[model samples]
Target: MSHSIEITPIDDQCPLLHQTKKDNIEEAGKINGQYTNKSANHIIDEKLKDLDKYTSKKFIAIFKVNVGLRKSNPDAYTPMLISIGPYHKKNPQLGSMEKYKLMYLRRFLQRKRGLDVEHCITEIEKLKGIALKCYDDIENLDNDIVDKFSEILLLDGCFVVEFIRECSGMKPNREDKIISTNCMINLVLRDLLLLENQLPFFVLTKLQYMTKEVDEVPITKLVKETFFSILPKMAHASYLEREGDVKCIKHLLQLVHMSSHPSYYNSLWHVQDLSLKIISKDQDYQTWHANMPNVTELCEAGVRFSKVGNTYSDLEDRTTLFDIKFENGRMRMPCFEVDDVTETLLRNLIAYEQQTCDVLPKHFSDFAVFMDYLID
Candidate 1:
């Protein structure tokens, strides 16, 4: 004999089933009430906590390059020889230079008879609040960050101050390894200009004042003499001389950026307006997809290319490296010597403009995009 089992389905009014449903509903209600009981301001505060960290007035200019921009050329944004600031302080490749930094720090403290490492540390520690705010990613630091950060500011600040001094002809030691050879000096300069490898200008300035080194010379003058000697001129001589307000400069990279900015504001505006005309009103200016005709195409269509010559003759009447113009079927552009140094500098400048798009005009990026169109 075969037996078959009969199944009974759950009924709508089953007491156990009703109790389970009621329990789930009550638990969900409790969870919902926890949120609903919050005041509107409390809800908003919770929502805006992350935004507040970034948008606060205390936040300053230094920022990490966005990953999308950085991934294209990782080496372009990284320091090769020496690390500066807290961003790359722990980079293993940069570890070899820490000894040299310490040596420089020793030399820095010796500049004044009464100056000592303890005093320097104490003074820098005082500026900790201001210095810390100048960089991004401070929240991700470890528990002992206060001590670590203060130490970095001291060493890096001393290294920069001394390095600039040595470069400015202040009688560097004959055996100094960093500036001992031309290759090393160039590498150090390249490393210093990387956006991530920078301390706030104020930290260096304060260190200088504390030691009373180069008291007569402004830090800007020392920087110009040191940095400009190695970097090829990307702007007119007058533009290089037109220093940004020293008080406003954030770091070495920014100072160089400001010095190289094109002086032809009217031309920049005209170019920007021309770009605006090409895009539909609904499209974003940044996302406008139009590209100018390449050089070959323009040449095929009866355009002439000429290099702007004799720019150094009269600095007062010179156009900047970025001042490209087209008129009467002739295209004139400032000549640029393309090489390793130039590429490195341009790449970093473009990266800076890309990362700081909100606060800064895209002068470098626009110049690069124009170049891209011309080249290909």
Candidate 2:
């Protein structure tokens, strides 16, 4: 006969386990916390007092990209020409653009012929709490936090507003550096849309309202004009204006994502189940859940592909980037033109969709997965 002996678990507070808070308590005492006997629960509560700041909904929008995702391609998410917001404000490489920010700020102040710079600064200061809460990694910044953050928002916000206004129609000075050069304009446009290079949209709106011309056009109108001028020819101003004005734009990238959202997908797919059933020539029950046949396989099976016309006014009520339809052995898709910045645009968009998946439907992610399935 054999007997089993049960092993008892050791306490988390046991000194032998080397998990007790004694050392921490001694360190705290050395820092002048005075002597006291604190329970484990109390200690843990103290340590996690600021936990809710991170978990709150107010702070959920902006975040650093996941390490796994960033490691895949750091350059895709990093800003190239100029940095915006607190995350990249300290990068030495972007220092060259700082002078332009101040220049724009001076121009913005001078535009209204008595626009108080202090008034703009005070307004940005009021938003410090809300702005700080939007960023997840802002706490990592070193000293002079208040002044540094306020200055960043003030400078970057003014620069973006002025840049957009100039791009829209405001004639720049004859010697304007960025606006005069097409190459620099394109680079700055790309930089503004990076995931890590962003400021909360409200900040921009506030600055625009504070310094807008007496009969200034709507900010949305200005944004569309600027984006339309630089966006790829395939996806022009009409494409970005599909959804009209969005009510809850988080940032520039999010604005672009919203504008590029496919209305066709919105009408057909179910959010609860992110899969759709597509009837193939061989099978009627084929869903996106399975390993679907590739494009070549479908073509070999007697499927014909055609490019849909770009003008959506004649076809449907709305235009979409991912407009594809299959019927009567024919697959019709909207023409997509790939340029140099296309990959960077799509990568940042996919990153945004992945990060905000909890609050946002995975439009770009679904499109990417579908494209992968078709190509692979």
lDDT of each: 0.72, 0.70
Shift in Å, residue 31, candidate 2: 14
RMSD of 1: 7.8
**lDDT value for candidate 2?**
0.70
lDDT of 1 at 178: 45
TM value for model 2: 0.79
lDDT of 2 by residue, 1-376 (tens): 9999976674433343245376675555535544455555577787799765454655556778888778878888888889988778778998898888988888788777667878877888998888887776666676575457888899999999999988876744563544568777878898888888888888998888886777888776677667654443224434545445544778877776666655554465332132233333343334445646668987888878887756433223344555666667786766655766777877888888888855456666766776776788
**Candidate 1 accuracy as lDDT:** 0.72
Displacement of residue 62 (Cα, Å) in model 2 is: 1.9
- How do the residues 1-376 of candidate 1 rate in per-residue lDDT, one tens digit apiece? 9999976675643443234575365455455563334355576888788775553444566777778877878888888889888888778988988888998888887777888888887898888888888877776766575468888899988999888888877744464544578887888899898877889998988987776644448777788777765554454464447474677878888887777656565445334443333333465556644644677877897878898744342334455666676666788777645556677778887777666645355677777777776787
- lDDT, residue 217, candidate 1: 82
- Candidate 1 matches the true fold with a TM-score of 0.79
